[model samples]
Structure formats: C-alpha cells, structure tokens
Target chain A: MSAQDILVLAEVNQDAVADITFELLGGARELAGATGGQVVAVLLGHDVAKHAESLSAADRLIVIDDEQLADFSPAPYLAVLESLVGSEGPRAVLAGSTTIGLDVAPMLGAKLNAPVVNACQQVAVEGDLLKITAAICGGKVLAEVEVSASPAVLLILPGSFRPTEETGAATVESRPSPVELHRGAVTFEKMILPAPGDVDITQQDVLVAVGRGIQQEDNMKVAEELAAVLGGELAASRPIIDQGWLPTTRQVGKSGMIVKPKCFIALGVSGAPEHVEGMKDSELIIAVNTDPGAPIFDVADYGVVADLLDVAPALTEAIK
Target chain B: MNIAVVVRQVPDLVEPLEIDASGAALDVDEVEFLINETDDHALEQALLLKESGGGSITVVAIDFGQVDDVLYTAAAKGADRIVKIPYDDDDRPPRPAEAAAMIAEAVKDIDAELVLVGSSAHDELEGVLAPLLALKLELPYLGVIRGVKPGEGGSVTAFKEFPGAAMAQMNVKLPAVLGILAADQPPRYVPVSRIRAAMKSTEFEEKETAAAVPEPNVTVLRMHHPEPSGRAEMLTGSEDEVAARLAEILKEKGVVQ
Candidate 1:
C-alpha cells in the first residue's frame, strides 16, 4: 500500500463529540506531519456532522451520518469503518482506546490483516516503522512496539495525548456508509446514560481514594471528609465498589478510569498494578497504608506508613 | 444457558519477575504461578450465570505446563467439567493466538452459548486472547465487560465499561465470547470442604495441544525497576506566595501558562 493520509476514527456520543477524539487528532497531527500526509478524521453517527468543528485540527473531516449509526453497534460501526479504510487506504488508522475502540480496533485489524496496538500512551514515526509505547503487564512495564505494516490500526489510551487548541481550516465532506447494517443479527435495546452522580475521577485534579482498608461502608466517611478538605473527589479500589459501598464508576483500576490527577491520595490501597496503572501518571502520588510493604509505595512519590483512618483525619485537619 | 469459561494459569502478579540471561523469556523459577486474576472474574461470572440460569458450566484451563491443581480450584468454584490442554516440557510458551485456537477447539464439541475469558492475562500475552478466540471461534466478541445478563432469545447483553464516564450495552448474538473485566465481579471463594471434594471427585481429561505454538517474536531486553519519578519541588511561603510559586512551577512544567 502507498503512504497515504492517516485516518482517525473520531468518536461521538449523543451528538456530542468524545474528548478522546481531539486527543487522537493531536497525535494524528504529529504522525501526519512526520509522514508528510494529511490527517482525516472519520466522524460517524446521526447528527454527528455538526460536531465537525471539534475536528478542526485535522486537515479533512469525513462524515458518515446515518440513523442506524446513531447508536454504537459493532456490526454497523465496523462495517462503516472497514469500508472507509478499504476505499481511503490510509497509511494508518488511529482511534481512542476507549470501550468502542477497544472492541473495534482488533476486529478491524484482523479484517484488514494489519497489526493493531492498544492502550498506547505514545506514538512516533521512526523511519518506516511506527513506534508505539503501550502500558504492558498491567502498567508495570511500558513496551515499545514497532509496527512496520502499512495501514496499521492503533488505539491511543485516554489522556495520553494532550489535546492542544491548535486551530486549522479543516475541509468537511460527507460520505454515505457503503455497508448496510442488518438488525437481524444484533439488536440494540436502549442507551442508558450513567447517572450524573457517577464517579469520574479522571476529570479531577485531586482524588482521595479508599480501598479495602477502609473496611466498612460507614468508615468511608473518613475518606469523604478528607476529600472534602482536600477539595478532591472520593474514589475507591475494586473491593470497595464490588462490596456495593461505592458505585462501579468510582472504582479506580485498569478496567476503571485511568486517572492522572495532580495529587492522588490512595488510602488503604495496596497498589496492585491494575490500580497503579490507572494512577501512575499522577503528578503527586501519596499512599497511606498500614502495611509498610504495600506495593502502593513502589509508585507513590510520598508514602505515609500509618493507618489510613488515623492518617487521613490528620491530613484532612492539616489541609483544612 | 450452557457457559464455557477460559481460565489461564499466569505468573502471580505479587511475585517479582526476572528475565532470563538470554533476555528471551521470563525466569519461571523466580515467578510463582496462579490463575490470572481477570480470568478468575470470568469464572465467577460463569458460575453466577450457571447458578442463575440452571445450566451446565465447563471451565477450560489452557496451560503450557502442569495445571491440575488450578483446574480443581476452578471446579470447586462451580465448574462442572474441566478441559486441560497438556503441553510437553519441550513446547514453547503458548502464544495468545495458539491459546485461543486451543480454546476454540475445546468449545467446538460443547454446546456452550457463551464463552467467557479474562480481558487480559497478567503474564505473557495480555488483552489479546479473547479477540483472537472470538476470531477463531467465528463468534461475536466483546471486551472489558463489567457485567453480563443473559437475555431472551439466546442473546447475552453485556455492560462494557468505557473511559471518561461512558458505557455501552450491546446484546451479542448467542454463542459469543466475552473478555471479562477485572472490575466486573469479585471472585468467589470456594469452601475448603468443596475444594477438597473437587480435588478428589473432579477428573480432567488431558487433551494434546492442537496448534503449533508460535515462537515469541518480541523479546524483553532487560528487566529493572523503573527510575523513580517526581522530585518534591516544594514552595513554602504565605498562602498567596505559595500559590504564586506553585503556578510558576506549573508554568515551568508546561502544565499552565
């Protein structure tokens, strides 16, 4: 395949564009510059064309608007994406490593017979090979993968790329999806948006996270009080969320939100890689655990060896 | 509601891993092996599905070495049958594609409506198994599934966790494979009595490895602790002064103007 434009699958939800779409556009801009190619952002979903302004960083925006594409279905989305890639023949396909991208990336890679990389924190064009660095082994290790194949598919991790406010006059064009979506094989029942109270630690600057050490639901008040003092949000480890003390949205781990807060105060967190991977990018990591040998200390910039219940209140008082 | 769960015995996460002197493989002697934590969630989901739907559950353990003990543990947790793929000592490390192939083969004979595997393994291959298995099995696949509810008409609706306050629920056609998220459900602990009974009563039929184990193309050059990050560039002064200093630091760090 010839060296062509870099195709970015711009993700949109409920007529609003996802944040990662611009983050990917940032990376695609860099890649396109290196490859001497244009960045084409592929926008899908009904009424998604109106959000084309967000893709201003791209050189061109390709919109595929369809009523069936309103909701995210693997069959319809993949069908549209596969057709676009086939016809466009872009040098590489970039997407956010979000839920939709994770589901679609590998399948697209398999279909196109190209190499696919997921959760990549960084990407650079190194000569002919696309060098991608992704968190491997539960974020304990960063593996640099070299993809030599053309038309490669990549899923960039959320928050990995800094979406700069670089303005450009991107030309917008509309295209009809070639593949007809069949409702017989798979069907969508409804779209349930998470409640407003959902825990979104990724957007926070500081997070006071509780873990199994908090022990009981009532005891979580200590964490809340500390969070209030720190002006941060209250998050939890998987155990706390699994126990129903916290909603699944509040869980901070590999499967949960990958947070990069300015200050992350992990209370009673054991710092498993799954959890650590989510918070390793934090500017300041302070772990308070009773166990001195807890893995949280490995990544924490400052570690206080004391009971969370005791230390949390003291810290809260100090901050106040 | 027949369910098939894939459990892989991976190097325990707690243990420190060492790359061999050749830098080609991990030192097995230095690492302790346990069921991949994410796969345990898959098994738990399978058990819960079986219990709720009153269907048979089969747990398949795809390992490169001895794993009977792990199989017994899975059985105690509510696996009705276990399929063990016995690998010769000379066999190379199992690739994700090869493991997926073996799993697809094992499920070919069983009338399983859904196959659940971990979203990713802790050791060796990570996050590549379920998709590869889905491709091999020619079934629709979903990854990062936090919760799954068996739906009407041989469909399984899965709640997938997305980044940044987003979730997508998709109803996969029957006989699909789901890569379970670690944050899905807490793993269930089997009673000691049940474990003992499973250890004695459960028998695994060892099947020969079907696919040719692919050689690992990628190699880890060396393993070392990551260089420590973050130096405490503290600023001490009056509240306003401290804020000004912090902002200066942030500006220097390119965080703020």
Candidate 2:
C-alpha cells in the first residue's frame, strides 16, 4: 500500500505555491483516497516551507529548503525528484500542468522507465484502474486513457479540478540535498518582464474577446462596434496579439492578461485551456462559435452555435 | 555540430473538423491536412543556431497526413537533412509517448547534438511531445522558450516565458532539447516559388519503423462533447431575431439597459 502512495511536486511561482499547485493537491487527495495511499508534497525553494502549513491536502510534506535550488533549472530539480522516487517508490507522481510540469514530467518518466499520462483534465478510478481524461484536436476529441498500472506520472491542467477546502495536520520533515551543490549544467539568468502595453484589460467590467474565428484583421471592426455598443473593453486571444491585431495588454489567457470581467463575451474563441484559464471566472460568460465541440462552449454560461461572421455585426446592430 | 528539429503534421482544427465513424479520431479523410502553427519555430531556431554556430540541421517526424509536405517545407526553410518514419496512417495516430519512442529510435542513428521542437503543437494537447521525446532520448529539455543562443563550452542560453510579461533566462548544457515558443523571430518566410523548387530537388529520407512504433500506453477509450450538458440556451432564427434574443438576455444579466 505504501508503494501506491502519490508524490506531488508542488510548483512555486513568485515565492509561493501556485494556484495550480493547490488545484493539483486537491486532485491528489482524491487519487490517494482511491488507492488507499497517502499524499506527499515535495517543497523545494528558498522559503518554501512556509507553504507547508497551507498545503492541507497532503498527508505529509517533505521540505528541501536550499537557496541553490531557488531558480528553476531542470537538472537540479530532476536530481532531487529522482532521489525521492528512489526512496519513496510512490506508484504515482503528480505535477501541476505548468511550465515546470511540462519540463520535468517526461524527463522523470524517462529516468524511471515509467510512462506518463499527460494533461489530464479529469482522473477517475474504474475498479483498480486509473483513467486520465485528455483532449486533442483543439479539445474537440476527448480521450480517456489508462496509464501504466504499477506507477504513473500525470500532468494535470489548471482549472480542470476544483481546489478543495479540506485540511490536514501533517508534520513536516526537513531533508538535506541528496545531490551535490556544484550547480547543474543549466544556470539561471535574469528574469525579463513583458513590455507595458497601452491599456490594461483587467480593469474592465465587461470584455469582448475574439479569437482566430474572427477570420481576418479587417473584421476586427465588427467586434469593435460590439465592444463599443456594450461599453465593454476589447480583448483578444493569443493569435490576435501574435498577429499584431491587438496590443499585448488586450490579450487574455495564460501568457496574456487574466481577466475576471463581470460579463465576458467570447467571439470565435475555441476555448483552449490557456485562454479559458483567463476568462473562465467571468460572472457571466457567453461564447459564440460554429463548432459545437469547441472546448470554449464547455465552460460558457450561454453558448451560441453560429458563424461569428454572421453573428458579430448582427449582435452589434441589435445592441445599438 | 548536428542538430535535429521534430516536425509534425496536424489537421487545421480551426477549419471544420469532423469525427470518424468509430468515433475513434478526427475524420482525416474529410478534412484538409496542414501543419498548423508549430515546429516551424523549432526549424527557425535550428536555422538560427546553425547560422551563428556551425551545425547541420535535420528534420524528423512520423508519417502523418501530409508529413512529406511539412518535411519539404522544412527543407525550403533551410533544413539540411529530413528524416521521416513510415508507419500506418490507419493505426491510431501516435500519441506523444509513442511518437517520442518512435522518434528516439529513428534519431538514435542520426546522432544529433541538439534537438529543437515547437513549444507545443495544436494536436499535442498541453504540449507533451517535446519533453516526452527528450525523455525517450534521455536529454535535458527546456520548454516554453522564446529565445535561444549558443553559449561557451557547448551550452545554450534559453529564455522561457513567465506570466506577467516576465522571461527567465537559463544556461543549459548541450545534447539538450529546447521547446521553442518563439524563435529569435517568427519563422522566416520561404516564398512559394522557393518551396516548389525545393519540392522538386529535395530527397526525403523515409525509414520504415513500424516495429519500432510502440503500442500506446494510453488508449483512447471514448470521445464525446463536453458536458454540464445543455447549458447554453441556443438563440436561433433570422439575424434580427437572434440579435433580439441575445439583447434580451443581456438586459436580464444587467449588462445593458
């Protein structure tokens, strides 16, 4: 039963365990309950131990406080995790589907000769089996997959599982660095900040965000009229920003600005998790897309199945 | 130095996508296939590295719909060598793990010093391919990189994206993998005339790796629309009617008077 325990690598962003870490910890609790195993959190950072008290989802927390491991260089993190896996032999290793998770999960899986079930939106146990639900073809095709039985590594997408409010009285254990301090091959350089854009879309109460389905830059005028009529700010998904159709500040999603607008209307946005993460919390969401299977519709409070080309200007005229 | 870039072919999901009969996968027979918005960044990154540092660039992929066109396009963009694994188009398309194993087996013979791939492919949800491929190759991989440059002593410095417009720079040792979110710049545009010229002259090296294609550890049991079912109240009718319907809802929500 100890072999089946789950080890979670808590991710730290800006000196704190990220929201995704809390989300994954919540998922880990459910998984541990299914396997009758304990959940352990690996806390590695300059002052990461402070998070130990807040990580109530874990049955135990292993704190490896070291300044040398402060920055995210894959080699050192891998070294620590490999050593932990060696000693703990947990059957399942869970990581947040962040940059760190994408960087580390596969490498660790390769090192352990184990298979990885990546980007699981949902996890369920059918009898003794673990099924990871993932999406492909831009979230149109949903796949329910089973990882290797004995042990599996999973990268769970953010916003898929709700963070639980459960609490635990887990004791913390401090361990010395198992690997030498001579710094791994990868060395951290300075952090480069994004340029400040013209307008901050986060401050707006209502947002009208567009994606590739808008088809061309010229059509942006139609979306503009809608935004203007509704007195909402204009925002876009990444492609629009990448194509220079809009300023970076007006972009919404993981790599862009996160907006919790009171009312968000998504036009032609297919709702990739990255984009969804930014606007999913809008008090009211209305998504218009031609593709019924588009992932954006999954999260929308009100969904419209129609071509944006037909609907955009029409909605603007009606609103006027 | 030898460098390899993993090129992938995927359906332009932005266009209409249809599900297959068994509901197993996308209906490839009906949809148009193209290399959508990935890997070419890796190609550009490889070219940039080759230009500044000395290296031969190789493009690698498994046979998917229109992969030859993608490899040929890579050739047009300045890949020195192109290799593709010939596998069944009917068998379930290779998942990230299986693709990595197949690519690793084929790449073993090429002996690349560094491998660069797009940060994430649209088809490879949550960006799994590069890290998975790097693992099978047993190489250290850096993901979500915006920029990369050759460093002293066979190491490279890569800039990875952080939220709130922050970028982290790291000096990673060579024989490594880099997931290119953006190259030094967007992929250099190879003109249509040059690509057609490349198509005629290029020699694609295709290897039969059906046996090397490992069975997918993860099997897709079923596919269906997402639920919290019937949540959206569809507003249908003529344009005027639909607009009136939407406006009424907005008024109810207090977004407008």
Candidate 3:
C-alpha cells in the first residue's frame, strides 16, 4: 500500500523485448499517471539487460538476469512475481495478454488474492477508479470492468495501444535473479511448429475469407477474382475448407491458423465464435454479408449488408 | 490417479441472445445453454490422459444450461465419474474469480491429482479462470495448452501454442491444472445411444459445499448495447454503388494495387 507501484513485466523473446511488452508499458505509463505513482518495468531473462535501454516507457527498470529463466516456466516465474508483489505491494500489475502473461498474471492474482481482468483492450481512469474494457462472448459484447480490489492484475490484449515514441535508458537496478527456486516443477522440453504447406497464411497481410454464404463451388471464382484484384490471398471459414473447396492451409479459425493480417475481407463469412477467435485481431475487418444481422458485424470495422455474389465481381471490376 | 475436468454451461452463441430486463444479465429463458467450448477440449485432454496412463477422470460442472446432457456426454466420452455443483443462473458467480472459488472447492473435495479446464470460457471471457482456480487450489497452471500426454514419472508433457503456430514442449508436475485450447485430437463424437446409456448408469454427486455461494466483489452498474462507433462506415444502396465505394476505400488504404 505504501509503494503504490505501477508495475509492468517486460517480456523478452529471442533476445529482444517483444512488442506486447512495449504495449503493456504504454498502458502502465498512462495508468501510473492517473494514480500519481511510478511506473516500474521488470525484466526477467538470461542477459536481458540489453532490453533495459529500450523500455523507455518505464520510470525505472529492474533487470533480473538468470540463465535458468531462459525459458518460461510457471513455477519459478510465479515465485518471482509473488515475492515481488509481496515486497512492493504495487497498486496495479499489468502484463500483455500473451502466452507468458497468460501463464503468470492469474497465478499472481490468486497468490495475492487480487482480482484479474483479462484481454482488456482499453484501460482508463474514471474519477479515481481504474477501468478496463474487455471483449466478451467472442467480441459480440464488451464489458467494462472496474476492480474492487487494489493491486489488481490486468492481462491486456496486444495492439490495443501504441508504444512510447522515444527510448530512454531508464535508471536501471540490477538484482541477482532469485536462486531460491532454482528450478520449477515444470520443465521445457522442445519447440515444435505446425506442419507447413506451400502457402504460409501467417505471412499474408490481407486475406479474402469466404464462408457458406458463398454457396455453390462455382461461385468461388468471384471470390478468387476479388482476391486477385485486391492482391491478397484467398482463405475460407471452416465450413468452406471442410467442404474441400480449399486446402487446410487456406483455412482461418480456431482449429486452423491464427492470423493478424493488416486487412481482412470476410466476404460472405458468418462470424462464428470459433472463426472470430482467430481473425478478430485483424487491423481492419470488413464483413460483407446479405444478413444484416450477421454476427460478424458486431466486431467489423466496416459492414456491407449485401450478397457477395452481387458485390464481389462488381468490386473486382471497380478496383481494376 | 484422478483427473478433474472443469466444465461450465454457457449461452450457446449460435442461438439468439437477448439482454434481460435487468440490462446487466442475459435472458436465460430465451437463450439456449450448452457446455462452454473450451471445456469440451479440456474433457478431451483428460480422457486422453486416462487412455495413455491408468487413471480415472471426474467431470465437474456447475449446474446450468443442460448440465446433465453435457455430463452424460462426458460419460459417453469415457469420464469415470461426474459431479454437479448446484448453481442458479440468476445467482451464479458474477465474476470469474468467484466462479473459480466454487470450482476450487469442488476440486479439493474430489481429491483430484490433475485438473483440466478450457483456456477461456464464454461467460467469463477473462481467460483467467484456470489460473485463478489453480491458484485457489494451490497448484501450478498452464494456459492455451494444445496437447497433453502423461509423462514417464508423475509429470505431464504439454504442447503450448506460441506465435506462428510454434509449440513449446513442457513437462509439468502432476496435480497441476492445464487450460486446454485443443486436445490430442478433436473430442470423439459420442453416439446418442451411448449418451442415453450414460444417463442410465452414470451417477452424479452433488457438492453440498457450494451452498453458500459468495457475493461478487465486482458489480456491473449498468449494461450497454454497443453504439456503432460511427467509425464503422456502413456501405449501403445498390450493389454496384457499394462496390464502387469499397473499391475507393481500398485504393485509399493501398490494399489494392
């Protein structure tokens, strides 16, 4: 209660500060401002000090370098966070809603009896109260959560905020990484990748995703023409791919590949919870469907309530 | 060894949804309830563990939205036991932390050596339930786990989804909770007859410990229907007109050559 520290855990991967870590700092700084507190960034990794100079968003940087922490294991990481929260008694803890953050935040919340707000896309201060807006029902609805408890841990969604414009070699404090839990009950074995095919959808910046609304197999030519005119790759929802109209490689959804393209044209795609799970993160989601009540419109940045058959070729011709 | 899989019933997203008169809650009467999506994957993981290693799996569901049907489905998928925590949709835990509290109590009473839950549930949407439950049970937890296999000793090897479909192979100690994203395989489809047979033979134990459902620390003051931010410019009129407008916007965004 005394320190009132606003802490952000700076996560590193492949020897660099990940973008999400920077995004968290951007959030932490804004939160720190309203609370009249100091923003502290904690870097825990092997030789992670190199990243200390880049987290300019922090008022202070605490670097804990340990070879044992080269990989993320919940046991040791939780031990470190628990001990830190115990000592610092921060006002709020913010981390990226990433693989590592997801693993660590709730565990910390549980240990401290603090509440956790996950996947909050926005954080703001409303008259001395900290508030977060989070997606619910796969983005069909939004919930603005206000914590009843201080020192609440927030797992923030990435791409929600912009990073600090400038870099500062913040005042650095190096602490000997805790050796108390030299090893965790969990151990990392190896890393494996999903089977690769001729087309790597992950690299595509824009995708023309079709769904059952595309109707007959022959109708796909219109989608292909639209995709070609747009200079983007053609993909499909699970139903279309399930019908063998496209290879698994061109599928987009929870069971398929998770993609964050710069722009996604969901032509005739009915946004199911599973499908939205994968593509909701797109920068701009344009949903075109005949049903004005299509669930995709709930999260779409632009909506065209019309049949794809009428629009696809007309759009392709217009573009050409 | 006993593995406890936490299942929750939620408003089936495919069905129509209506906000109740209270504004803060959904109209449970109108909405169809189904087992939360992630929970299905979690049950699959537990069943996979049961097959690979000699163990019994106990499926636990907080009574709501076709709990018996989902529990029976789990039985047909080979869960050895089932437990239902009597809960009222009207008076259910308002937040994920509180929900985890009820689940943690049930897990302890069952004396489960391993816990599996969906990475995220529809109702909570916090993506924190598994970790919160793990903490409440004083167990190590992992999130967004794809595959799980019982390891040589008292540990389990898990495949975790990373950026770009990469996976990190990790071994966790037993008595841990895993937030499952996918299982070793799609949950086996249980035939309707098997589910019916499960209904006849499988017995459900009600946890009397959850009688005192605690009040939520967080409360929603009001509810809001999204006002289309006006940022989302709707395209209307004739097909050609809409298409022309879209093309103009695409060209401005440089999405088109």
- The DockQ values of the predictions, listed in order, are 0.25, 0.53, 0.45
Whichever of 1 and 2 has more lDDT, that candidate is 2
Model 3, B115-149: lDDT tens per residue? 99998766674437888888788887888887888
lDDT of 2 by residue, A56-127 (tens): 668888888777788887777887888887788886888876778778876777667666766578987666
- Which number leads on TM-score? 2
Candidate 1: clashing pairs of residues: none
Ten residues in a row with the worst lDDT in model 2 chain A?
A: A141-150
Give me the displacement of residue A223 in model 1, in angstroms.
4.8
Total clashes for model 2: 1
Report the CAPRI category for model 3: acceptable
Q: After superposition, how far is residue A19 of candidate 2 from its true place, in Å?
A: 0.7
lDDT of 1 by residue, A1-320 (tens): 23767888988755677777878888888889899889998988887777888788889898998888887766678888888898888888998766678777777876776777665777788787887776554445455667777788887766677774778888998877778766534556666565886656789987989987897778999999877866778998866776668776787875567788887878898776557757888987777666655667778766666667776675555555
- Cα shift from native, residue A185, model 1 (Å): 3.4
Candidates' chain B TM-scores in the order shown: 0.82, 0.84, 0.84
Chain A TM-scores, all candidates?
0.79, 0.92, 0.76
Error of 3 at B113 (Å): 3.5
lDDT, residue B46, candidate 1: 86
Superposed Cα deviation of residue A72, candidate 3 (Å): 0.6
lDDT of each: 0.73, 0.78, 0.77
DockQ, 0 to 1 scale, candidate 2: 0.53
Cα lDDT, model 1, residue A173: 88
